[model samples]
Every structure is written in structure tokens, then in C-alpha cells.
Target: MPPFAYRRSAALLALAALLTACGGGSDDDDDVGPATPPGVRPVAGAEGRWDGRTSTGYDVLLTILDTGETWGLYHTGPIIHGAFHGTSGSSDGQLRGSAAMVDYDKGGQVHSSLYGGSYVPQRQLQAGFVFDVFNGSYVAAYERAVTTAALAGSYTGYAGGWPHPLTLTITPDGGLGLTPASTDCLVRGSIGPRPGGRAVYDMRASFTGPNCPLPHGASVAGIAVLDGPRLTITSVAPSLVDFFAFQGHR
Candidate 1:
């Protein structure tokens, strides 16, 4: 259950069924309405291809300094080779948190991309995601995901009693971008490689933070593999899927 802190907590609660840039870490509810903020705590997911057998979900790249707060990078295909790397952030005293990169090949499939630094996507979902990367401060807890495959390029894992620094990047149109180490914070997305491998579209990301406050009905369902491969989009209101497997070579 330590797949790099559940791969940064289900990559932020099923990121819009696979990323739309923190698009409702748990579904921002139809333009923010219910107003459930105060001590929110939702983002808690971990499906690290449990090593049943099939998992070649490799190809990763993520980098974030101690400011970007959150970052991005993604990949899709039978990876699981060594399950990439692993880590998750949300200090008990550790610092900032999140993790990924696992494609051992058997049934390798898991792609994630993220980046938040616009100031905790509206107070970090009012604490639903909780925070404490030591002192950088935190208070949001919203995340998502479900599906993948690959063995492309890029990979990194360095969690040394941290404060920040999670990097990843995978392109080829599967565009997964996240850079922290100096900038401030940046997260990008675009991974739609379907057919036989999987991931038709996970996180086509389109974001806008800074003074974030536009939620209603609040919707952010989880589960996804994008579209074609295995566990297809499941929830997320009208669309937002799920389904994750590979350890057994599925």
C-alpha cells in the first residue's frame, strides 16, 4: 500500500477520470455549491498494480522544487518494470508528498500526471487532502485515476525526508509535464494512447488556479484507464472512469 504514497493519492483523487488538471480532485461539484469546506479530507487512493503478475507500467518523469507545491508527468503502456519508483506526500513529519513510476511488464499499466502550485487549488480542497510537508504548509486533499501501459522514457524517485521535489515527464503526444526544482510549480497533461495498450485519454488537463473558487454540486468521481485497454472510465458524474489492474498480467 506504499506505492509511493498511493501514487500521490490516486494522482489526486482520480484526476478528472485521469487528469484534467486537478479537475475536481474529487469532482468540484457542478461549479461549487454544497460548500463543504473547513476540514475536508478525501483524496486517498492506492492501486499500485499490486504485483499479481502483469505490470509493465513504466515510463515516468516528474520534478518539483519546494515551491511548485504540486507537479506533473505521465506515461501509458505495459510498464511496471520495477514499478518505476514510489512515494507519497502528506507529512506525519515527512514533507510535501506524492509518488509514481511502475512498469514491470507482466500487465504493467498505470499513468499519472499532476502539478499544483497555484496555491493549493483553492485551499487544497479545504483540507480534504490534508497537508504538512514540514512547513511549506498544506490543506487540500483531492485526487484521482485508473489505467495505463508503456515503457517509454523518463523516470525519477527521490524522497529523502522531503520538503519538495517530485519530477516526471513523458511526451510523444502523451504529453505529461511537471517541473519543480526551481521554477515555482508547473503541471501539464496529455496522454491518449489507446488501442491495445490502453489509455484513450487520461487528464487532457486544462487548469486555472489562484484564488480558486468555482465549485458546485461538487463532482469528481474516480477510476479510469482512459478508454481502451482495461478498466474504462467509471464515475466522475457524467464521465470519469475507473479500472486498474496488471499485477496478474491483465
Candidate 2:
């Protein structure tokens, strides 16, 4: 099984700074401090606890530490658990890691073992696959999750004299479907499973439709901020002087 085929939008404004190392010390100089890798950072936009579901519908819980390492818990025909030590870079969008899984019996004995898979970041969401090393079969689909019922109902906003109505509907299984209105704009993409009770949500704002001024299929990566009865959405696009923003009320 693999992650659901989630469509990706446009480029996002890079948000983190990469670390650098210098080598000017003498051969025997002990004053040189430990240097962080050139690409690794302390944290990134992808750090957090996430609740995910595989294409097979198995539930998964993943915690990505600030150090960019990951621990995961899942079940695929058996109780499976694993720890994935992964790394993220400032300029790279993919989070790669080696994974190992232990299948335990009812009595807590190790029944089988497996390994493989890596994390991939797409637009505003992060997802990846894990494999059964023996057969090469796998399970996937990892999205950030938040408290249930945190984002529901409809929110309305405006931009450039145009009224935009955003509606978010959560599925019975915790999937999200978002429909936002814009003047002659067709908004495509689902929004749900906000990041672990946080106010921010990853979004794919693809603007398409007749009479729309933006480029056809012009995509944008965005984040939605939720505040009591109020929702704010913003995106960055180089073609525009300022980022696109819309403030809505629930």
C-alpha cells in the first residue's frame, strides 16, 4: 500500500535557514566547536506529531522530533512499530530516513521484521511510504493531524473586491474536503487533518476557472490560520508584489 495520490500545488516561500561550517583552525586547534551540517537545521516547517492513514486505511501515528528524527507506530495485519531516524535539509524538500519495523505477537514476542521507506514533502503536506523488507510490499500516506472537530463548518472571506466563501468538511474517517469560493476562480484540493491541534494547516490553492485573472492552473502553496471564529489564509507567489491573503469569519 502507498500514500494516497495527493496533488501538489506551487512553490512555497522557503522559510528556514541552513547552517554552514568553516575550517580556518590550525591542525591542532582544539577550539573548533562542533559544526552543524551545511543543510541540516534545528527544526523546520515539518516538525510535529502527525496522525496518518495508509492507502489501506490503517491508522498511523508519527512524531517527528525537532532533531528531524522520526518515530512511528502502525499495524498492517499485525501490531507493528518502528523508529525512523530521518534528516531534513534547509534547501531540500525531501526528508529521507531508514526505517525498521517489528511485528509483535499477541504475547508481545517479535513475530517478524521488516524495513525501508522514506518521507517526502509535497507543497504544504508531508507524506511517505514504509516497506516490508522481505516482500518489498508497503504501506504509506502520512499527513499531519489535529484534534478532532477543531476545524468544521464554513468561513467567508474577501480579496480584491471579490467575496470568497470557504467551506471545510471533515470526513467520517478524518479526511478533509475544502471548497472555497473566488470570483471566477475554481479552487481544487482538499484541506484537513490540521497539524496536531495547531492553528496552521497546509493548503494547495490552485486557482483555475473562467474570468480569473491569475494564470491558468497557477498554483500556490498556502497555510491557513484558525482563530476563534476567524480564519486567515495566505500564499506567496513571485509574480505578485505582495502575498495573497484572505481573512474569513466562521
Candidate 3:
């Protein structure tokens, strides 16, 4: 999806998750025994690294800790990076927080930005907007990940086009090979370690087959979350515009 589209989608997903979790019944309904008590349960699916791009092509990297704290880095162009810090709360299955950063100009002028958004746990999605006297928004999907050895197996899924089977072979040495049955794309990449037990991987493939829609080469970079027999991959680069999702079960 385009940056704007994903941002909107993330916002909607976050809102829906919040409404579903925090929604209350009408007065006509009986009181459900004073409602369930909210606790410091450390929200699920938000404590990880999320990488994405802003609508303006800025690279965004977000890291959420298990302690409800969040830190992020935003890259504007090649070598300009800014940092922000904030805290988050999980209530009724929803995660939300506000973060800020102070920037100094060449003459040491102070500038800051404030941002807040909702976390959609089901898709491990983080969607929110920034307030810097300028309106900006971002949407990023996350993956709960483990080690590479734990992910060794053959996965059959579809990417790019619906119903096109894509087979992946993940090796223990952080290397992988991909074969898409519907296209002649030769994909190869490595999976590197990220904080919090998650793996960050990138793939560069060239379309050598017939009738390929993509350019000669495209980059696929994202994180993977593995659970039992299932694996979920989130695209920070290609996004849904390149491929809807990469889902596979062992």
C-alpha cells in the first residue's frame, strides 16, 4: 500500500482494536459484576521492533519495551536521523502512547515533535500521527520473533499476487531461498539478529522469468514472528502495495 493508505489502515485497525477491547455495554444491559479489573499485564504483541516508512519517504524505526516505554528513530533523507522517547499503556487489549523529540538548528534553536497512536495487536500493527506543527502519520506492522534455528523449515505461502504459491527455505545459518511458483523471481537473502529475540531479514530478487510485473530487482525487508507451527512476516519496505502478506504454516 502507499504510505498514506497504510497509515489510514493502521489507524483504523488500532481504533477497531481499542473499541473492541474498551467498548462498554449500554445502560439497559446488566452490570457485569463491576467490570474486569485492569492490571499491569504488560501488553501483548507490542514489545518489539517495528520498521516502516512515512508518507514522505522518511524511514521510521520504532522499538517498544516490555516496560511500557518506547524509543524511536526517524531518518529524513540519507544521513539525518532524529530520536524520540515516550511511554505507552495497554488497556483492554489496546496500546497507545505519545513520544517527543527535541531538535536543535544550526544556531541552536529548539524544535520538538509530539506523536501518539494506537497499537493493533492482532496484526502487530502500530499506527499513529505526529504533531510537529506539521501533520504527519505512519503505519507499521510488527512480528514477534525468535531465533533462526527455530524457524528452519519449508513454508508455502503466497506473495505478490493472490493464489500464487511461494515456497521458502530458511537455513539455520540465517540464509534463505525463495521460489514463487507463479513468477521467475530469484530471491535470496540473510536473516540477521534484532533485539528482543526477533530476526531482521532482507531479500533482493531479480525477475528473470516471463511476464514479471516488478522491476528487475526489488528489496524485501521485514521481521518475522514465529508461533508454534505458524510464521508471520511483516513488510516494512515493500508494504502491502508490493504484496498483501507473507503467511506460512509448517
**Winning model by TM-score:** 3
lDDT value for model 2 = 0.37
Mind sharing the TM-score for model 2? 0.34
Instruction: Sort the predicted structures by TM-score, highest score first.
Output: 3, 2, 1
- Give candidate 1 regions above 4 Å deviation: 1-73, 76-87, 90-101, 104-250
Tens digit of per-residue lDDT, candidate 1, span 1-250 = 2222234555466332322223122222111122333453432322111101112232222212222223222224322222222233432211233333322232333343332212232222211111111112221211222123341234343221122334445454455444432233343445543222211233342223331111222232222232111222211222211121111111
**TM-score pick, better of 1 and 2:** 2
* lDDT (Cα, tens digit) per residue for candidate 2, span 23-84: 01012111112333344333354454444455455555454545454444443322232222
Count of clashes, each model: 112, 1, 3
lDDT of 2 at 11: 8
TM-scores, in order shown? 0.19, 0.34, 0.43
For candidate 3, write residues 153-244 as lDDT tens digits. 77776442233566777777767666443455655666644543223333233333444323345454545444346444533223312322
Worst 10 residues of 1 by lDDT: 126-135
Q: lDDT: which candidate is best?
A: 3
